[model samples]
Target: MGIFRFSDMPLKKKITLIAVVSSSVSLLMACLVFILSESLTFPRVMRQNLSNLAQIIGDNSTAALSFNDSRTAQGLLDTLKANPHILSACLYDLKGQVFARYARPDAPQYWPAVVWEEKSEFSGGSVRIFQPVLSGGDRVGTLYLESDTREMQLRMMDYTLVTVVVGVLAFLISLLVASRLQQRVTGPLQQVVDRMKDIAKGEGDLTKRLEVTGKDEIGEVAEAFNTFVGKLQGVEDMKLDLISVVSHQLKTPVAEINGFIENMMMGLTGELNPKQKTYLDEMRAIGRENYRLITDLLSASKIDRGVVTVDLKPVSTKEVVGLAIRDYEVPLARKGLSLELEGVWEGGMLYADRDKLVEALRNLINNAIKCTDKGSITVRALTEGDMGVIEVADTGIGMDAETMGRLFTKNRVLGKEAHRSGAGLGLYITKNFMKQQNGDITVTSEKGRGTCFKLAVPRFKPGEGGRL
Candidate 1:
């Protein structure tokens, strides 16, 4: 298994991460303060020990110098050496030279200083004490004493150990608290995620709301998600209702026209003359328009219900375009317009539904012929990138931005002129059918210039490749 990245982590992990990082920072700050306090206290305790030793050495030095006896001074120094705290002792003359020195024999060569301005070196824990000798206010020698600080060192060590133990206990307690906090934060988020997954799988019930407890950001998120789901459900219901009403309204007119056309064609009515036959032909044409409208309504209804299915196959784009042109040739000639086919290929194939592709192409052509006064409509196909592009360009009265925006919307009439001739479901049906086939349609137009509709489909085998 691969290691998870931070971005891929769930809400629970993110909450846990926040808790851990915050606790770690707090613990570090506490440790820093403890170390600083210990460092400050250690130096103060050592200085206090030095001051006490200095006082004791000064009293002994005063008695030795007053009696003017070297034996007494030496005896006092020997007694000081026997003490566990004392490390070394020295006596200096009036000229600051070491006249006499008595140190512990087992002590290190580098003994602690007493009167020098700089500190001295000693083994283990050490303190330095200085004493000046005076007799009748006359210049005399100085006494130096060195002492060990093992007791103070042991005290500091004990304090440090206690601090470490307390810190560890605090960290463990914080871990428990963090876990509980993470649970509280992630619980609602998990519910929201599960509900979203249900909605994506088509279970769009808006009443499935999360139980909001606290007024925190997580609760707010849950409330917002509930609102969003509710709005989505309402919109879906509205679309379904619209499709139902539009279908009923369109089907009635289409069924009536179909019945009328059937009756006339079967001669169920009276016989017709040449003029009457022409009128009947026009009525048949209107019936065909109504049939196209009904078909478009059905297609739009299916698309809205999300029930449209595509049958993908490796079909030749050239063959479909040729068939579309063949279907519209007679209509184009009758409407005083010309149809031009360009870039015909023997094996320009695409992966799409051949029947749907032909239907989409015919819609675009019919739309062009309806809008154009007297101009040529061109259908061209070529390969660009990894897709086959079919373009239908017409030198017709092109649409403005307002019309173009509603061109692919269901039942949206572009203008009164186009509506008087036919309904405006051609482009809408074309767009939906293209989408069902894993393709897309795009358009470009200007008011006085022209309009071009381009269909893009994934290309099939170009040279010597296998079937899709």
Candidate 2:
């Protein structure tokens, strides 16, 4: 019932169906055009030949008719019938009476009555001639003739048979050509489908590629598909490598925390004074920080695995930015940095997952606070173009061009003095989160000047803002 219903059928059957349908329609049209052209032109040709023959007989009989010599007139009529194509000859008086008639019995009987009047039916056809034929102002008896057109009918039949035969041959040839064309096209497509099936079933063989034999559109599609599969396989390999490295990094910190705690429990480090207990507490805090780092790493990995789904809704961008700044207030103060919020009173709603947006803003704020010392961190929100823009600018020790270039790259930590304490996952996670929300983040930094990170969230329309 649908156009694509036959898509899943076997390739051979599809090819056959296309070939048969196309050939049948082509043959039908060809036959119609051939028959119509012949029907129109054949009659006009027969009529022209009959007119020419009548002119000749009329010229020859003019003298005999004027003199009233029946023998002379009859001789002209006999001569006219000698030609096989001239089926009938007739002479009429001025009173519209048939004075003489010559015809073949085997031909159609309508010829004799057809030639006596200005408009008359002739041997299965029609003819017309003027009575009292005039030549150089002379009067002659009315001359008329009829043609059977049986030979013309026979010729037309022969032509029709030839056209039909040619149409059938052409249809057969087209069917064969179409079948070959379909094979060439669908063969490569089927190969790609089979390879895709194998890949879906966890086959990792990257050697399989669709063969490219031509420069057509289909061949280009095959090449593009092959390139995509190659890149996907490469990503899979990199993912495996990342998991292995992250696991090892996590295990080392966990092992150190466990060993340090065990040593304290066993009193192997010596008896602890009050001051020493404080140092131990600091060590425990460090262990907790390590644990938190591991948790964040796991969260980032889950994001990469597409395990996190966002619930998008309209939320005030100002409120979200203010909340992120508030969460990092104490840390910013401790680092001798001021956290400032501007444009908070402006009402601009963004369509996004509120929780995800908050998380993304928090990461950026944390990074800004950590990297800036003795300078202010400003979070600004406003409408820009079709988007709600949130910018976190820090007057900290900014990074160089090289560091800024690799800032959002996975596992890349900008080795500036301000970034010594961070794991480099903050911006990566923030970038990914923005992408999930159909938003984007950009960074501009110059060494010792300042760093400004911009986040753009699409503005929400009234009644169009809801959970995605």
Report lDDT (CA) for all predictions.
0.75, 0.73
Off by over 4 Å in 1: 1-270, 345-347, 411-413, 417-423, 462-468
**Residue 268 CA displacement from its true place in model 2, Å:** 20
Question: Which 10-residue window in model 1 sums to the lowest lDDT?
Answer: 111-120
Scored by lDDT, model 1 comes in at 0.75
Off by over 4 Å in 2: 1-31, 93-99, 107-117, 120-132, 211-217, 239-468
**Can you give the TM-score per candidate against the true fold?**
0.49, 0.45
Give the C-alpha miss distance for residue 166 in model 2, angstroms. Answer: 1.8
lDDT of 1 by residue, 1-468 (tens): 589788998767777777777887787788778777877787667766665665565466665655556667677677766577666777665566665567777776553334643243343467665667655575466767677777667767786787778777877777778778888878877777788888786644655667777789878888788788778867876887686688788888878877887788778887867787788788888878877776776777777676788887888877888788876767788878887778866438798888898989888888788778778998988888877889999988898998888778766766776665656767777888888777899999987667999998888864655333
Judging by lDDT against the true structure, name the best candidate.
1
Q: Relative to the unseen true structure, what is the C-alpha lDDT of residue 118 in candidate 1, on a scale of 0 to 100?
A: 29
**RMSD, every candidate, angstroms:** 11.7, 15.1
Q: Write out the backbone clash pairs for model 2.
A: none
